[model samples]
Target: MEGIKRIYLLIGQKGSGKSFIGTLMEKEFGIKFIRVEDWAKKIKKDRNVDSEAYLKQVFEENENEIRDSLTDMDKIVFESTGLTEHFDIMLESLRRDFKES
Candidate 1:
């Protein structure tokens, strides 16, 4: 695993124990666990909307914030679903930007 960046992503239905397993990784390996839903929840609270609409709106509106929050992080696990593809695109964009710079 030398020089390889390792990331563990757990995708599943809500209330299906994703956070429970994430907590295990946190305790056992000191991997930081970030619940993607928490961000949406925060945004929802900020917007004062209790609807599920905040789920997608959170990403659409705050993707940069989400991406920036992860800057320089290490040994982390992200529990996510819908945002995975968007995150991957962001990562690739960052890689290309770094190479060009």
Candidate 2:
């Protein structure tokens, strides 16, 4: 099997153009773009919860989905704010999924 490669994680503060950069990368490199907040919102809608605990749960659940999707793709661009405490989790997920090419 071909080893996974070409994973890019755009980390920065909110409104810092990470998503825009990811969009450009997607167009230029034919990579998939995974936006974490959008995923979290989808999960939240499904769970139908407005509490802090529920939001946290939604984020965690969606993060796993995002990670799994990234792991199986050849090229993926993940855009997120790097200020989160769970940033390490995102980095480790990418590192574990793809080898530098």
Candidate 3:
């Protein structure tokens, strides 16, 4: 079975070009790019919950979904806002997963 060989976590302030870099990676190198905020948006839309109150839950679910989708992928990039304390859980999970890879 194929597994991830490389992981890029793009961490920076908001309005920086992390997502742009991720997009460039996706387009130029065919690496899979996972944007956490996009996942949060989808989760909010699907669950109809308050994001501020349920951010941890949303991020946990996002991490789970990202992990589940990693099978057969070799390179992946995650675009994240490096400003939230709550995001640490997901970041740690990603680090664990990438280390295992």
Candidate 4:
């Protein structure tokens, strides 16, 4: 698979402008914007359960989806609160796999 040309990570606190920037990027640059929190919320609702374990599982699934997208996508954007072990692990994996990027 081809490496992604660009990966934009928007890390910020709640009520910040990360989401705004992500939206702008998607609309203006045609980049794929991934909002992890929204996806996590959807997963929680679908499962009808609440637990850190399940949240972590959802995070891992999202990470895998992002990694998989590196094949066909040239650019991608991600919005996160910039906390959690899962985020750290995902960053490490991205660094390892896309060292050139």
Q: Which one wins on TM-score?
A: 4
lDDT of 4 by residue, 1-101 (tens): 65447788999998899989999999999988888877787678647435667767767877877777666788888888867777787778787877654
Top candidate, metric lDDT? 4
Off by over 4 Å in 2: 45-63, 70-72
Q: TM-score for all predictions? A: 0.57, 0.68, 0.77, 0.83
lDDT of 3 by residue, 17-48 (tens): 99999999999999888888887777675564
Candidate 4 deviation (Cα RMSD): 2.6
Which candidate, 1 or 2, would have the higher TM-score against the true structure? Answer: 2
Better TM-score candidate (2, 3)? 3
The residue ranges of model 4 lying beyond 4 angstroms of the native Cα positions read 1-4, 46-50
- Model 2, residue 79: displacement in angstroms? 1.0
The positional error of residue 60 in candidate 3, measured at the CA in angstroms, is 1.0
Which residue pairs clash within candidate 3?
Answer: none
**lDDT: the better of candidates 2 and 3:** 3
lDDT of 3: 0.76
Deviation (Å) of 12 in candidate 1: 0.4
Q: Give the Å error, residue 49, model 1.
A: 6.5
How accurate locally is residue 35 in candidate 1, as Cα lDDT from 0 to 100? 75
Give candidate 1's whole-model lDDT.
Answer: 0.60
